[model samples]
Target: MVQQRTADRDGTQQKANHTPWLEWVASGIGLLLTLGIFGSIGWQAFDDAGAPPAIAVDVTRVVPVEGGYRVEFRARNSTGSTASQVEIEGKLAGDGAEAEIGHVVFDYIPGHSERKGGMFFTREPRQESLALRALGFADP
Candidate 1:
């Protein structure tokens, strides 16, 4: 009986001393994966924040709305910086004279993105030669 008790004690000691190699490996792998995910997110944010600012405006279409003519346009940001208070001006000319002028403002436009807006003109913009210009932009 005493020999049996001693054997059981030795067995318990051996189990307690066993190394959890698999658990350690799994924990390390989990930590690495977490770091990789956070690193990718941080890199993307850094890349976008450091971009410069370039703006382009294109007059796509001019259609007459109920009250006035709506000038459909697209604004594109090619630089790495965000633009705020983007002002676009439109001029309509007929018979070599400026018929009407209109302007639109965009609240915010991020870098490498495009936004659509419109300007209202009291005159028929389709009948006149349309001139679209990006007046200016403020840093966001």
Candidate 2:
């Protein structure tokens, strides 16, 4: 009986020694994976911080002419970057209402300028200077 008990004890010790160390390894790998995901998110946040803001726009003038209205405009990048494919909207403000009369497109270089001509509009006969609203910027 003592020999049989000793054999059982030895068998128990053998099983304990063979315990799966892979579980410990897997746990460490999981920890590393979690840290990697968090680090990636943090890196993305930092990158976004350095990115420029949206474009800013301005309208210099809109004046009535013989055949049409002349539109003079300017666009600026407040984010300190070059803005391209810009769409500017001009509106006429008169007759108790404001109406979008025209749209134009141009590229605004960063810290520079672009001038456009041939802005024409047809107005009703005997009309005076039309009130104008102008909005300009790079595409969203």
Candidate 3:
């Protein structure tokens, strides 16, 4: 126990209140931190609210799998918007034949990030005109 004592004029030692101002300082800091966090969240919510998701799909690699060929693709979200349920399609057309189409869906493609997926195709992707495209995406 810490107590501060003072002697009176009549030679009497009395106890004095000796409380530091730590609570006030801690409360002030907590309030400021709460306000700062809310401000940052508000800024981020409004900053990219209208920004569209510029999701692009690029074919990275192709390899022969069990049943057919596997085409690995990279889905890149260039804008500040996150994309969900991103649907990507790959088409192979060549030699006056019908185009073979394969598609895959990604769960999420975060803002300014990339996600990888693969699709299966019966035809050889390297020998044909391989085109990769992001069909559509849902806002996350």
Please, what is the TM-score per model?
0.62, 0.40, 0.63
lDDT of 2 by residue, 25-114 (tens): 999899999999999868766654344535444546668887766665555544433456666565554555454366767655442334
Instruction: Show where candidate 1 strays beyond 4 Å.
Output: 1-42, 45-51, 126-128
What does candidate 1's lDDT look like per residue over 32-76, in tens digits? Answer: 999999998787688766765677888888887998788899999
Worst 10 residues of 2 by lDDT: 125-134
- Give the candidate order by descending lDDT: 1, 3, 2
Candidate 3's residue-wise lDDT over 2-118, tens digit each? 233333422342223443479779998999999999998798787765688998887888899988899888989988788899888888986789988887888998887999888
- Model 3 pairs whose backbones collide: none
Please report the candidate that would top TM-score against the real structure.
3
Cα lDDT of model 3 overall? 0.82
Q: Kindly provide the TM-score of model 1 when superposed on the true structure, using C-alpha atoms.
A: 0.62
After best superposition, candidate 3 residue 129: deviation in angstroms? 0.6
Q: Which stretches of candidate 2 lie over 4 Å from their true place?
A: 1-49, 96-98, 111-118, 122-140
